[model samples]
Target: MKLDEAKQKFVHSWGVLGSNWGINKTMAQIHALLLVSEEPLSTEDVMEYLKISRGNANMNLRGLMDWGIVSKEIKIGERKDFFKADKDIWEVARRITEERSKREVEPIIKILKEVKNVEDDSDKAKEFVETIENLESFTSKLDGIVKKFVKSDEHWFYKNMVKLIK
Candidate 1:
């Protein structure tokens, strides 16, 4: 494939992958673009290249910044703001995992804990409580694992995980 074609394919694929990970396609595309860029990109550049409205580009750029994967750059003697991706794959994965766990897992765990605290004596209620308790237990464990993974460097975590599996 031609180089441009390959880059387009990568951007599209990354957009699709982002949807699976709970981010919008445009946000992923913007991130993908920034990732491959040799230099920081301005909002106008993003709008023109992606053929997206200025609003769409701006919003997703801000979203990327919030996710800690992209950041703004201000050049000297220029007023326009440029953006760039973190570029380190390990750090990128770590940030995504940490953000997702905080945003999704923590809320689910909180809801499950509340459900487990309900007062009821019926058989169905008892079963509901038991099921919720189990879910809470599993989620708490998963949260701990995610926390550990986020805290440890990637190499150490993967190495220990491999050792434990064996």
Candidate 2:
């Protein structure tokens, strides 16, 4: 593929992956644009590059910022805010992992804990509580692993995991 085609393919693929990861496609496209950009982009620039509406650009930019992967930049003698993405791929992946864990995993653990507290004296209730407890245990283990990954360097963590598995 040509350079431009490759870039377009990357952006499109990243957007699709983001959708699968519970993020909107446009938001991922915006991030992909910023990731490939040589300089920071203003909202207008992003809208123009992505051929999106001003509102769409602004909303997705805000979403990326909230995820801590996109940040605002100030150019000297310029009033307009430019945005840039965290160019480090590892950092970007780590931030997304951390955010997803906080948003999805933590709430699930809380819900499981609450549901496991159903106090009743019947086989059905006992089975329900037992299932919930098991789920809670599994989720808690995953939560710990995610937290550890979020806090540790990717290479170091994966190396240790490999050693443990071996």
Candidate 3:
């Protein structure tokens, strides 16, 4: 298949799959473009190909870099910085797992901790506290699982997580 056709399919698929992972479609699409490209691409090239504005390209590129999937590259003798996405799917997944743990899981744990510590003794407060404590337990277990997966070199974590959910 031609690069354009392949890239479009990838972008579309990634955009569709992105929502479940807490990333928006456009961001995923931009990442998909970089991921499949053989050469590093500048923001201007991305904007033109994706038909998005400069700001949109910039914002999404930064987000991809934050997720550790896309990296900025400077070509020799070229002033404009280019972006390249990670070629390994597993590395992408692992980076995403780490980032999601930090973004979604960590804050939830903090909230659960704070809520469980509330000093109210009323029945409603008691219920709230009990619920929060339970949440804290579950979230803590989740964090533990994520930590275990991140430490290991195996792919079983993702499979086990899916199993755990099922």
How high is each candidate's TM-score? Answer: 0.95, 0.94, 0.86
RMSD of 1: 1.2
Candidate 3 lDDT, 23-132, residue by residue in tens: 88889888888877889999999999889999999999998988889999999999998999999887777788888899999999988887687777899999988888
Q: Which stretches of candidate 1 lie over 4 Å from their true place?
A: none
Q: Quantify all predictions' global Cα lDDT against the true fold.
A: 0.93, 0.91, 0.87
How would you order the candidates by TM-score, starting with the best?
A: 1, 2, 3
Q: lDDT at 128 for candidate 2?
A: 95
Model 2 segments more than 4 A misplaced: 164-166
Q: How close is candidate 3 to the true structure, as a TM-score?
A: 0.86
How far residue 71's Cα lies from its native spot in candidate 2, in Å, is: 0.5
RMSD of each: 1.2, 1.4, 2.8
lDDT of 2 by residue, 38-122 (tens): 8999999998877999999999999999999999999999999999999998898899899999899999999998888876989
Clashes of each: 0, 0, 0
For residue 14, model 1's alpha carbon misses the true position, in angstroms, by: 0.7
Residue 158 lDDT, candidate 3, scale 0-100 = 62
